[model samples]
Target: MAQIDWETLAGRVENAPSLLRLWDALEDYAQACRDVGCTEAECGLDLRRLPTYGGEWTGEYLFPIRDDGITIRSHDETHMLLDRERAEPRYVVVPRSAYNL
Candidate 1:
């Protein structure tokens, strides 16, 4: 019934032991958050159950939909914790408009 703690969730994913598993966790958690946000359910828990078993993990953040042929520069020098499923420079996009010129 309680809302998810996404910040805490992301931190866990960012520090996951395996980037592949991290990608999975981030993807799942983010998607769950998106679904709950769209539905606006009064009882958040009623939505898809948390993907992780222990309370340390928040299974609700999905991978970001990035633009194709675009380069992302982290002004803050942030690093990417990518996996085999990492987004590519020329990856797929949806809604058409999601792709920028």
Candidate 2:
């Protein structure tokens, strides 16, 4: 069985007082989630192998968001997740010319 740190995640900084702190907290959680996919029952799929933004934009991230089955795209797309609880979908395009970036 894979190990998931519920402690560090329990007291997450979802709404910290500082911007840096918030980003740092978000980045931490993003990295952790990327490292270990969402095990939340809210996410029925196994996304423990998805990629998270590493504070860099060199490559692209093309993974599926478990909460609503929306495609998460990075790399020049600058995609964002909106109303994960909603069913409406958004588009994320990756240009063929991005390979050179």
Q: What's the lDDT for residue 30 in model 2?
A: 49
Give every collision pair in model 2: 37-47, 37-48
Could you say which candidate leads in TM-score?
Answer: 1
lDDT of 1 by residue, 2-97 (tens): 777766665555555543455455565556566676421342322222222222212332333244323221111122332222444222222222
Task: Write down the lDDT of every candidate, Cα atoms only.
Answer: 0.36, 0.39
Off by over 4 Å in 1: 38-101
Reference-based TM-score, model 2: 0.31
Whose lDDT is greatest here?
Answer: 2
- Per-residue lDDT tens digits for candidate 2, residues 54-95, read 344443445444546554433223333221224422222333
Measured on C-alpha atoms, candidate 1 has an lDDT of 0.36
Which portions of model 2 show Cα errors greater than 4 Å? 1-3, 39-101
